[model samples]
Target chain A: MILTVTLNAALDVTYRVARLHQGASTRVLSVAERAGGKGINVSRVLHTLGVDTTVTGLVGGLTGRSLRQDLALAALPEALVTIGQESRRTVAVFDEAAGETSMLLEPGAQVTGDEWRAFTARYAGLLPSAKAVVLSGSLPPGVPVDAYASLLRLARGCGVPAVLDTEGEPLLAALPARPALIKPNADELVATTGLTDPLAAIEQLRARGARTVVASLGAEGLVAVTPEGRWRARPPHRVAGNPTGAGDAAVAALAVGLANGAPWQSVLARAVALSAASVAAPLAGSYDAVLYQRLRDQVAVGPFTQL
Target chain B: MILTVTLNAALDVTYRVARLHQGASTRVLSVAERAGGKGINVSRVLHTLGVDTTVTGLVGGLTGRSLRQDLALAALPEALVTIGQESRRTVAVFDEAAGETSMLLEPGAQVTGDEWRAFTARYAGLLPSAKAVVLSGSLPPGVPVDAYASLLRLARGCGVPAVLDTEGEPLLAALPARPALIKPNADELVATTGLTDPLAAIEQLRARGARTVVASLGAEGLVAVTPEGRWRARPPHRVAGNPTGAGDAAVAALAVGLANGAPWQSVLARAVALSAASVAAPLAGSYDAVLYQRLRDQVAVGPFTQL
Candidate 1:
């Protein structure tokens, strides 16, 4: 079973309104809430892909309770550490007429020193039984910036793939720990390495100690520089829809493939297909299966070339 | 203790962000949540005024749990009925840059038939201990349009002042039940009675069996045509601020006044002063104590005019 860690889990509340009239009250046409975080999104895709996965992170207060309840529907087992502060909530307001969404994301509650230590201990305890570990999302306040690096160390000690999906200081700090796979989107890659060239950035990341670097190029699809083989994958056609969860879908496919020891081309194909399918789907962590089945074989995978 | 019933209560979540940009993700700088509903707002104001108040209605699931925790901080005792559905959540996005707010209100979860009966039974049980009972806010789904009428009947049967604070059909249905006082804003009065003149609209309400009619006129304060006498009251000077909770402050003062059998002039003066004080404060259910004290004596409370 794969283990996913989402330190800043949220109760993702989405509201559909007739129109978004700024500075005025709008009667919501409908509201849908679910448990969400980068890791949870990956876990959702993994579960749908038929991989056994468990989610563990910090869960606290009533928001945490609601999140856990939301997760119950997904049938996820949690070994989450309880904290004194409540977990945060994320609001997405969808305007039906305009077909737009404005998101408000809370920074999340501060984690105490004890809570961070408790999470580390729990992470270590859960590491041994997992085929892979995926550390995702931003670090909450008071957490050491090197938190994911510590988790990567535990995963390495247990001899399984440790996937890191985060940005900024956390990504910079975790690189030296040499996580098995680090999926940084084009923007995150530029922000971290200060280089516009994705291939050059991947080499820089490897030199800094990441075992493998997979860069998500948005509509252009994915480029990877792994130890075994360098590859590039692309969808047959661009799907015009939300790109929010596309990266998480790719991460899920890659994590599942790494755990199962799939061929590099097959893993890249699956990730590209799933990412495109997720983009066509209406909400995050959801994909169009019929579209996935059709696109899975259509993704073009070839040897990577210098950009 | 004053008893306030919030049939359709909410967890009012307020987020402060730098600027609200449509169709983009915003990082919320701060978040504050509180128990909210028209009746609960009244209860909050009464509690702040050092009046003992008990808050009751329907509360369930994790949102309810969070609301109850928030109420605990206010030292409120609950006689709330249990329900299977989670309570509603209201999001208020405050744009610090533009100094404006956009509110998203969910219609609230559907209340089961059993939950309605259970709430009425619980509301009745608390009626005996309350000096006065306030039935406020809109009816949630699955509740009858005449819910407040039933609550007014219960309060009448118990011989306590039943204050009705709502609009539309709920207010229309409760008129014949003769709640001790019904507070409707000028627009609500116009909508319900179809009369343009406040005095004529109030007379139509009295004709329909209402005992007293207190119409809130926003910056003009309030006008009451009661059995004791008729009075119009306004603050010494208009306080320019948020008017969100001004009506609720008036309701709280009126609830206290009716319970104590205060003279008409005394009740009008208190409400006008508190309402203005509340408007001057940053949040609803909170008032400027110094403003309230000074305005209490300075408010002009006298006979109503034809204007």
Candidate 2:
């Protein structure tokens, strides 16, 4: 079973309208909401893929109730820890005419030192039973920057592979704890490692105590460097669709592969395929199973021979 | 005691942001929410004025719970009927830099016939305890067009005066039932009666089932034609601000005045004063008590002689 943690879970709401005008009332044609956050999305995808996953995080207030209700309605596994602060609502306004989506993200939860202690205590109890632990998304307010680092250490102590998918300081801080695998998108990769070359960037990450590094290059595909080998994987053709959740889908695939002890080449192929399939699907945490199967067969994984 | 019915209540949310850009992620600085609807706003103001007011309407599901929670937190009075459907959320994104507000209104609830029956049964039970009844806002889906008309008849049967505030077909349909009073803004007047002349339009309304007619002229003032007399009242100076809830404020004053059995001139003066005070305040369902006092003393109410 995979355990995913999303400290800043949100109720993701989408409003569909013909067009959005500035400073004018927009009558939403339709409204849809889902439980969302990075690790929650990961857990949802893994659950959809028939994997045993449990999602644990802080949820509170009325919006928290709504998010929990959404998770229950979807029958996705959850073990949310309650807090005092209300959870956030992330709004996406979709314009049908222009085919554009504008988003408004509420600030993350403000977990106090005591709440963090409570969360850590709960997390410690669950780490032992997990095959892998994936810590995803940004650290909420009041949570220390070293949060992911401590979690990774605990997972390592339990002999659970810790997959870290984040960016900036938190990712930087967690690397020294030696997360089993780190997945950074092309932009996040450059931003964090400051190296233009993917291989050099992965090398820098490894030097920072990362065991394995996987970088997502958007429509381009996946690049990885591991102890066994280094490989590059690409989709036969780019799927031109919303790529918002493609990276998360790749992370889910990677975590799934790591749990199953799959080879690097096979893991890269699955990551590239599932991610492209995610882009094909409209929803963020979902993919077309048929498209995924076809893309899995079509994705090419080869040795990283380029400089 | 007064009774206010909001057939389509909502959880009104306001988001404060530095700016809003199309197709971009906006970080909201703050969020505030409350229970809202036309009659709900009236009930709130009435409660603030120490009037014994019970707000009755349809409320259900998560959004309804949020609205009810807000009302409870505010300690406002309510007796909302529960349904299987969830209530709506009306969001106003306030751009602090430009001082402009963009609203996104969720579609109204699709109430079932059984739900409407339930609401009517509840409304019938509450009518006898009220000094007056206010039926406000649009009729939700699956509710009959004659919903207000039926309610007005029930109020009249219970010897209670009914104040009707709405637009188009509902207003037209309710006129023959002769609600004790009907309040329409200038635009609603033009749309419903197709007459630019406020006095003539109001007279037409009085001729159709409204015992008394009051028309709100934005920035200009208010016009009233009651059997006792006809009067027009204006604020000493226009209060320039977002007029989003100005009309609702005027309705609150009107409901308060009618419940007190104030004379036409006094009611018109109070409505004009309170409406301008509402324009000065940032939120709807709120007025500047000091400004209301000052304006109440200074407002000029005189006989209306049409051009």
Candidate 3:
């Protein structure tokens, strides 16, 4: 079973309104919410694909309770650790008239040193029964900058392959532990490596100690640099919808492939197809199964070379 | 002790950001939240003034739990009834650069017949020991339009005075129940009675069965038409800040005055002073105690004459 860790889990809330006006009150017509975070989204996508995934994370307060309730309703297995501070929430106001969405993200509560110690202990306990572990999303305040690095070491010690999906310092800090795979989106790749070229940045990431580097270039699709081989997988057509959870979808596919010892070409193809299918679905963390099936064989996977 | 009922209570959350851009994600610098509703605000002000006030209404789900937790922190007494649906939340994004606030109001959850019945039973149980009852704010979906009227009947049966603060159909529907006092701001007065003139609207409200009508006219102060006398009380100077809970502050003073059987002039003066103090405070459901004291006796109270 795959174990997913979301240190900064959130309750994603969407408010539907006719129009949005700055500095004025907007009456929301409808509200929908669900448990969300990078790792949780990966587990959600894997769950839908009939994969065994357990959601483990730090959660607290009423918002945490609400997130847990949503996960239960979705029938997603969880082993969340409790904390003292309330969890954060992201509110997206979708304006039906303008066909736009504006968002406000609440900063997650600070995790104490004791809480971090407790979470690491829980992660260690879960890693023993896990085939692969995925650590995703930004670190909340007060957590050590090397949080992912510590978790990666634990996963490695347990002989579990680990997939890291994050950006900036946390992503760079975790590389020394040599995670099995790292998935950074186009923007995140440039921000982390300071290289505009995807192939060059992927090379830098691999040199920094990642066993495999899979970079998601939004509409362009997946580019992988791995030990076995290098490949570039492109979607047949762009799916125009919400791209919130597309990266998590790719990470889920990569983790499954890594656990099953799949070929690079097949793994890249699945990642690109699943990513596009996720964009086709309206809600985040969900994908259109029909679109995934339709695009599965259509993704073009070929050898990658530095231009 | 005054009993305040907020049929549509909410958790009011404020997010502070450097600037707000439409159709973009804004990172909130800080977040603050507390229990809120018209009647709850009234109860908060009354509690601050050292008045004995009990907060009662319908609450449910996790958001309700958050609200209740905040109420407990504030040390406000409560006897709220539980329901199956989640309570609503109102988010206000304060843009510091532009010095403006953008608000999103979530529609309250639908109240089932059983939930409403349960709330009424709880209200009935609280009314016997209450000196007065203040029913405020809009009705949630599925609640009867004449909900305040029904509550007013119960308050009267228990020999408790009722002060109603609402608008549109609910305001019109409750007037026939002959509440001891009805407080409507200038906008609510015009909207409820369809009269451009405040005095004309207040007269119309009294004719329909409201024992006393007090109209809050924002910075212009307050105008009261009661059995004892008619007077207009204006603040010494215009104070600027948040006006979200200003009217509720006025209702709080009015409820206290009615409970004490105070004269109209003194009641109107206190109401005008407290309302302006509430406006001067940054947070809603709070007032500037210093400003309130300074403005208390300085307010200009004179006999009001309708031209």
Candidate 4:
């Protein structure tokens, strides 16, 4: 089973409007609520794909209770550590007329020292049962920048493969701990390695001790480097929709492939197909099973050499 | 006792920030939550002034639960009609640097037919005990625009004075019901009467069967036209602070004066003083007792000719 961690979880509230005008009152057509955080997204996608996954994170107060309730309604397995302060809420205003999206993110609840220690102990206890652990999303207030690195070390101590999918300082700090896989989008790769070229950034990531590096190039598809070989995979047809959780879907596919001992080339192709299918689906982190299977067969996987 | 009704109540969340920039993420320095709605604001100010007040409104789900809990925490007496859907939440972002406020209002939960019947029955049951009733705030979704007019008719049937504080079509519809008093800010007064001049607007409102019309002109104080007399009351000093709930504070003072048997002129002066004191307080609809007393003595009341 895959274990996912989200240090700063949030209750995401989405409002559908005909259009959004700044500094003007709007009447929403509909509203939806869900649990949100990178790891939660990854676990949700994996669960949709019939993969066994458990999500662990810090949650608190009423908002946190709402988050957990939503996850339960979705039938997603989760183990959230409770805290004193309420979890933050993220508002996504979707404008159907303009085909535009605006976001207002609340800074999540602050985590206390005792809460952090409790999460660490719980994660450690679950590491033995977990085949692979994925650490994702932002560090809440009061958490150190090196928190991810510490978690990476803990996973390694238990001989579990760790997949790290975060950006900025947390990603940079965890790279030296040699996680099995690190997936960074183009912009995040550039920010972390200070390299404009994606291939060069992948090389830099590998040099920093990541066993394997996957770079998602949005519409262009996936570029990955593994110990056995390097491969580039792309979908035969582009399926356009909201691309909100496509990357999380890709990470879920990759973890599923690695745990099943799939070859690097096949794993890269599966990840690309799953991601494209996610964009084609109406909801985030969800894909049509038939479309995913058909796209997986049509995905083009070829050898690639770093310049 | 004064009864305040908020058909579409909300949990008002305010975030204080150094500055606000469009299309950029902002971190709030401080956060505050309060039970809010036009009628709720009026009740809060009345309670602060040691007036006997009971708040009645529709509240539902978790957000509604939070609103009720907060009111109890504030030591305010309330009689809430519970509904099925959750109450709404309003976000107010305060940019201290620019001294500007931006608001994002949520369309509150839909009110069902049965819910409306229950609420009206509950409201009617409480009317005989109230000396005056206040109907304020916007109508929630699924509620008719003429809701306030219906409630006003109920108040008249009970022989209790009713104060209407609202805007747009709701206020326009309520005028024909001949409420005891209607307090409309300068903009709302102009909108309802289609007259730019304050005196003319008040005349239009009075002609529509309203027994009394009180027009609030922010820093200029208040103008009132009653059966007894027409008068203007001005604050002795300008207090620099938030003016968000000053109008509601003025309406609360007006209710208190009428309940205490104060003359029309004294009621107008007390309204101005209470509003100014609210401006000096940190929270909206809250007045410093000491400041209010001092300002009450200094309020200038005089006869004024219609412009």
Best of the candidates, DockQ:
3
Report the lDDT tens digits of candidate 2 across residue range B118-146: 88998999987888988899987778988
The superposed Cα distance between candidate 3 and the true structure at residue A6, in angstroms, equals: 0.9
Please report the TM-score between candidate 2 and the true structure: 0.98
TM-score of candidate 3 against the unseen true structure = 0.98
lDDT digits (tens) for residues B97-157 of candidate 1: 9999999998787998888998999888888889998888899999999898888888889
Would you estimate the TM-scores of all the predictions?
Answer: 0.97, 0.98, 0.98, 0.92
The candidate that achieves the highest TM-score relative to the unseen native structure = 3
Model 2 CA lDDT for position B54? 86
Question: Candidate 1 residues A117-218, lDDT tens each?
Answer: 999999998988999999998998989999988888888998978889998899989988899899999999999999988888889999998888889999
Instruction: Provide the global lDDT of candidate 1 against the true structure.
Output: 0.90
Q: Model 4 over residues A186-250: C-alpha lDDT tens digits? A: 99998887889888888888998899998898978999888988888988977888687898889
Predicted model with the maximum lDDT: 3
Candidates by DockQ, descending order: 3, 1, 2, 4
What residue pairs clash in candidate 1, if any at all? none
The fraction of correct interface contacts reproduced by each prediction comes to 0.96, 0.84, 0.91, 0.19
- In CAPRI terms, model 3 is classed as high
Can you tell me which runs of candidate 3 are displaced by over 4 Å? none
What candidate 4 gets wrong by more than 4 Å, as runs, is: A17-29, A95-98, A237-239, A288-291, B16-30, B95-99, B153-159, B237-240, B288-291
DockQ for all models, in order?
Answer: 0.87, 0.82, 0.89, 0.37
**lDDT-superior candidate, 1 or 3:** 3
TM-score of model number 3, chain B: 0.98
